[model samples]
Target: DAGITQSPRYKITETGRQVTLMCHQTWSHSYMFWYRQDLGHGLRLIYYSAAADITDKGEVPDGYVVSRSKTENFPLTLESATRSQTSVYFCASSDWGSRNEQFFGPGTRLTVL
Candidate 1:
């Protein structure tokens, strides 16, 4: 597989619980990103990593954490899930920069009850 994958594809958890969503890519792309897409809205960046050991927060990084210790994997964790956190989480990767074409994974639908 030369693309990205995310799991679990769907998750339902109670509020205040911690959950980690996994993302994996085979291309070892230089840049990886985590975004959440709510209904009828554009994707909002949560976190991103330039390369191994290099990570940064994006526009809506609150309550979310990310790490890129490995070049091909970036995981996102919700410290304390809230109803607002319930959305479709998409994982994407690019060669570099915001202008680079990004490839997206199927996505993880997280529901916080």
Candidate 2:
């Protein structure tokens, strides 16, 4: 949609290196989330922020970090990326109060070789 999208749609990285993926949205949504989707697997939550200065870790947050200091920008960073961290990262956002309808980004593909 016109709300959210990711960067570096495809990426290749080496082991034990840091990589950062960017996510941006047009609407000033309150809830932003990061998720990774593996082959033949469901979307796994990585991190999410309720608003500026408020963030929380999701199911799989190890080796990954996120910050939402801005209402329209939420970026995810992979520190010391490993082979296991090679996957497609998707960013989503939802309205603050309604807590309904999540818009997904195109996704960033990071490959750790």
Candidate 3:
């Protein structure tokens, strides 16, 4: 991928099944994030990491887990996928520069049944 990208761009899974969304970046930005976007709401943060091995929960972190073992990857997992967790997942990276603009990946569209 050129910059940031998510794997399994389209997924359909059943409830109680485990689902993991993958995010990768080529820029090696210090900050990475996972977000979910639904129909009526804005992009809600799931988790973020300032650097490798350093991560924190965001606004809506329930039913989700994240880890940054390497600088270029930040993956989000749902141990027991639920219907409520179905949404478009986005991966982003930023360097916290003067502008601090986040570069987003082509989102993953997940459907839970």
Candidate 2 global CA lDDT score: 0.90
> For each candidate, what is the lDDT?
0.94, 0.90, 0.94
Per-residue lDDT value at 77 in model 1: 97
lDDT of model 2, residue 87: 90
Worst 10 residues of 2 by lDDT: 96-105
| Residue range 3-98, candidate 1, lDDT tens digits | 899999999999999999999999979999999998777899999999999999999999998888899999999999999999999999999655
Q: TM-scores of the models, in the given order?
A: 0.95, 0.93, 0.97
Worst 10 residues of 1 by lDDT: 92-101
Off by over 4 Å in 1: 97-99
Best by TM-score: 3
Q: Candidate 1, clashing residue pairs?
A: none
Q: How does residue 47 of candidate 3 score in lDDT?
A: 95
lDDT per residue for candidate 3 within 11-102, as digits (tens), equals 99999999999999999899999999998999999999999999999999999999999999999999999999989999999996737799
Candidate 2 lDDT by residue in tens digits, 1-113: 56787888998989988999999999999899999999887899999998988999999999998888898999999889999998989999999567478989989888999
lDDT of 1 at 78: 99
